[model samples]
Structure formats: C-alpha cells, structure tokens
Target: MIKLLTSADAMLYREIRLEALAAHPEAYSSTLAREQGKPLAWFEERLTTSDVFGAYCAQELVGVAGFRRVDGAKTEHKAVLWGIYVRPQARKSGTGRRLADAVAAHAATRVEQLQLAVVSENEAALRLYAAVGFVEYGREVKALKQDGRYYDEILMALHFGGQGS
Candidate 1:
C-alpha cells in the first residue's frame, strides 16, 4: 500500500530510513551516523508535511519519498523531490515504482515540475526514474563527496505535461 505519512508514523519512518542508510551507504549522500543524532522533531515535522508519501508491503514500510514545496516566492509551483529510498530486499519488486507513483500523483495536483538528483553511479535508480517519465536535465561534476572520494550527480526533472506512469 502507498499512502501519505503523518507525524504519528514516526516509528515506521525511522525504521525504513535506517535500513536504507545501512544497505546503500554509497547511494545516499547522508549517513546513518549523521541522522542518528537528529531530533525526533525533525522527522515529526516531515510526517506532518502535506507532500510526504510512503510505500508499504503487508503493512511493512518498504519505501519512502517526499516532495518539498518550493519556498522561493516565485517557485511555489515547483517542488523538489527528495528522500527517495527503498529497502534492499524491496528493490525491483514494484515498491519503488509505487512510492514514486504516489509522489507523482500528488505532484500532478500542485506542482508544475518535480526535480530530483541521483548519484551518477546508481544505475538502477536512474533507470527507474526514467521509467517514471523523468528526463535528465543536466549533470554536476564532483557533486558529492564521501570518504575522500567524489561522485557525480545527475539532475533530472519530470514536467507535469509529460507522460508519467
């Protein structure tokens, strides 16, 4: 099942976030150690956001994605999509697609463009994002650094007028 999350869903959110960080340390720029110190209030606020969505399998949280409404006065119609991650065992099992679909469905209602960045090395994610109608807009060289190594990032966007399914 795919659904919007609430602050009350903190436990599930924390569990899934930890799993993602542990399983794909290279895929995400953030590390579990960094997030462990964050206050619960941070995640609580996220749970209450109008744009956060989650995907579950038999009631187990399997994936999560969120679209943050643009803050600039002139960019309200756009939203930056982020925090997209799926459990290792859940990859390619439709969990990622369902999570993305839920976000896209909500974006269709308010956003003109949905933008996100993916590490250049994550081919599976790139393919999945493309399958969902996101097209690469540009690439940033040495956009991310971790453990003394830098990684490129690909910026992608899905316009509301394009096919997304």
Candidate 2:
C-alpha cells in the first residue's frame, strides 16, 4: 500500500532515508554523514512540511518519495519531486512506481509542473521517470561530487494542464 506519511511515521522514514543514503550515496544530494546527526524531531518536521509518500508492505515502510511546491509566488505553479527510493528487496515489485504515481497525482492537483533530477548514469531511475511521463528538459554537468568523482544529472519535468484543467 502507498500513502502520505505523517509525523507519526518519522522514525520509519528516518530509517529508510538513511538506508537509501548509505546504499546509494550517488543518487542523493544529502549525505549520510550530515543527516545522521539530525534529531527525530527534524524528521518529523520534514514529514509535516512536505508531501511525503511511502510504500508499505504489511506495515513496514519500504519506499518513499517527497513532493513540495515552490515557495515564491512566481514559482508556486511548480513543484519538485525528490528523495525517491525503494528498498533493494522491494525493487521490481512496483513499489517505486506506486510511490511516484502517488506523488504525481498529488502534484497535478497543486502545480502546473513537476520537476526532478536524476543522476545521468542511473538508467533505471531515468527509465522509471520517463515511464511516468517526465521528459528531459536539460542536463547539469558535475551536479554532484562524491569521493573525488563528479556525477552529472538529467533534469526532467512533467507538465500538468494547470489549475482548472
């Protein structure tokens, strides 16, 4: 099952987030070293502020995705999709797709466009976003640097028909 996560699910969310960071450090902007020191209350605040969704298997959170609308008036029509991850055991089980679908559905209701960035070498993630109707709009060189190596990122976006559509 997939559903929006609340502050009550903070501990589970934190666990999965740390796992994602550790398991695939190249895929995310945040480092495990930085997040490890954060308090549980920080995670709870994140859950309360962002439109975070989780995929659960019999009460265990296995996947997560976050959506957040831009803050400024000029950018309010845009939203960002981020922190998408599914457990290795949960991959190929449609958990990622379901979590993404939930985020997209929610974004379509609130913004005219949904945007995300994927590491250029992550073919699986690129394919998944493409399958969800996100089209590549640009690429950023050296978007992330880890362990003395640089990784580029592909920027993608999906446009919804605006507020009334």
What TM-score, to 2 decimals, does candidate 1 have? 0.91
> 1-165, model 2: which lDDT tens digit per residue?
999999999999999999999999999999999998999999999999998999999888999999998899888999999999999989999898898889999998889999999999999999999999999999999999999999999999999986543
**Model 2 lDDT, residue 48, Cα:** 92
Clashing pairs in 1: none
Q: What Cα-based lDDT does every candidate model obtain? A: 0.83, 0.94
Give lDDT: candidate 1, residue 53: 83
- List the candidate 2 regions with Cα displacement exceeding 4 Å: 163-165
Clashing pairs in 2: none
* CA RMSD per model (angstroms): 2.8, 1.7
Q: Write the per-residue lDDT of candidate 1 for residues 1-165, one digit (tens) a residue.
A: 888889988878877877777777766778989877778877787677746788888888888998888888887877887889987778779888888878887888887888888999989889989999999999999887877888899999888964342
Query: How far in Å is the alpha carbon of 65 misplaced in model 2?
Result: 0.2
lDDT of 1 at 15: 77
